[model samples]
Target: MKALEPIDRTQRAQVVALTGKYIEQASRIFLRHFVMLPVFFDLSGRLAGMYKVHGRTRCIRYNPWLFARYYEENLAVTVPHEVSHYLTDTIHGRRGIRPHGKEWREIMALFGADDQVIADFDLSGIPGRSYQTEDYRCACRSHRLTHIRHNRIRRGWRYYCKSCNTELRR
Candidate 1:
């Protein structure tokens, strides 16, 4: 199969416009004006979209590669998914509700979108980064910890094996 091209400028514009449209709808539905969060197409890997908050900053990120392959589905589902996250956070404080709890589902229903949490898409040709893994052992089995996890362990964090209920160690 030929490698699929990333989303073009026109598609990017459509995504931004759709995001704005959803924000407008959510404001009307909730009877409060919701700020327009920034939209970015810098995500990769299997995930389709993400709603992220860093301190006072908030933004929605999309995988351009996934959008190129599943344009319509991403437009219909991914847009609403991220928008719902934004609205949920805006209405209910972030720490007060679960990420996919009832409040989020209610918002999704109000938006007339499926409440399914994750996008299931084949990522055969998507460009992804490879992480170095470290080997660790538990009582029952060996495990491969990604570089991120290994660094956390180095910084006094601990991980456990589910089956053996033992701490993972180098």
Candidate 2:
């Protein structure tokens, strides 16, 4: 597998332009002014793109490594996937509907893009994050939990062992 490299300026510009085009198409289809959301290439790992809302701020984030690895597919599928999320949020407010539910599917159909939720790609050369894990014990065996799950356990969430059917403990 080839080592991962950052996408160059021209490729980045093409992604931005394509995002704009999709946003325009959605705006026209919905007959509503969809604000051009900011696009960022700061994401990593297996996710290709995400439509994120933090408080009142919102932006579309793309994994540069994945984009560089799968340029054409990212341009065709990933762009529309994230844009459809943005459009669905704009129209339905993201409360009552699921992420890839009917509203999102409708917008995807309007965009004429595949409605598949995730891209299937070999991630051998792509850079990904490694989470630190903590060991826990059940009756039958020990389990390793990532930091996210460890924190949740500390916050009063309990995880059970499937074979032993007992709560995992530190």
Candidate 3:
């Protein structure tokens, strides 16, 4: 991995702007009561973004790493994807509905995104993050795990290889 790069505030500004645009689109059309929500970015790796509500205030927490890695796609798709979640959640308001239910799909369709998106959100070419990874080995293969996974393993957590059914060696 190369040196960790500084946070790109320009990209962050772009996300903020695009988020506002999505919120506007949702408000102007289907969701009559839709309103703008706050957005924050973290270095999360598991998900692109998530919509959360605190009492009457709704917000979005997203991964800056994703937006930095896939700049255009994140602007066009990822931002709008979370916007769908925000809109659907506002419409339902914690009635225990599924995140990607039929209503959410309809909103996504309004943004011209079907189940298939044209942009390449794939991370195959993205190099391992600037953070270090620890080496581990199973009977079948060697693995390099990120710090989060290594920490989990250190806490008495064991991972077994599916093919060999053998515990990984740290």
Candidate 4:
């Protein structure tokens, strides 16, 4: 994670061109429904890019914030990642295959990607999802754990009390 870079004409052009090239290459490999797809950019915080197949028009909506931060580093993989997703979606005839299933993985490998299952970006500044907690009673005392921890106990991982060394029960 580096600071966000200022994406300019060169960066924008490169992203568009690279996406077009990958689309062409994928078309050559497999018969796709559409040959040409539009690339769009925005200042998105969560998503790096998205392969939107609306009716007949296939498009890539990317985050300019990422473009400003990592410039080409983000696009080099992100663009192809979205394209692979498009391939995965198209190959399955739209919406049934897993997002990062075997087909998508194969496509990534073909495009020189390392088969990365998820994005590798900085999310330290992003707010974490909070959870509610419940109190569980042990032989010695009561302890508070998140709902997930409580569920783990219910599912069969008997939590222990550190001080008393006893199993906490709900």
What lDDT tens digits, residue by residue, belong to model 4 across residues 23-81? 88888878655465777875466677788877877788887776676666676678889
TM-scores for all candidates: the values are 0.81, 0.84, 0.63, 0.64
Give one digit per residue, the lDDT tens place, for model 1 in 1-170: 78788999999999999999999998787788999989999998888999999999999999999999999999999999999999888889899699999999998899899999877889999977788999999999999999999999999999999998999999
lDDT of 3 by residue, 1-170 (tens): 66434238887887888888878887788647566677788646546667777777778887776666667766667788888888877777658777777878888989886543334555543334477799999998998888888999999899888889899888
Model 2: what TM-score? 0.84
Off by over 4 Å in 1: 134-170
Candidate number with greatest lDDT: 1
Clashes of each: 0, 0, 0, 4
Q: Note the Cα lDDT for every prediction shown.
A: 0.93, 0.92, 0.74, 0.78
Candidate that scores best on TM-score: 2
Best of the two (1, 3) by lDDT? 1
Pairs in steric clash, model 1: none
* The 10-residue segment with the lowest total lDDT in model 4: 122-131
Minimum summed lDDT over a 10-residue window in model 3 is located at: 116-125
Q: Estimate the TM-score for candidate 3.
A: 0.63
Judging by TM-score, tell me the better candidate of 1 and 3.
1
Please list the residue runs of candidate 2 whose C-alpha ends up more than 4 Å from where it truly belongs after superposition. Answer: 147-162, 165-170
TM-score of predicted structure 4: 0.64
Off by over 4 Å in 4: 1-6, 31-34, 123-170
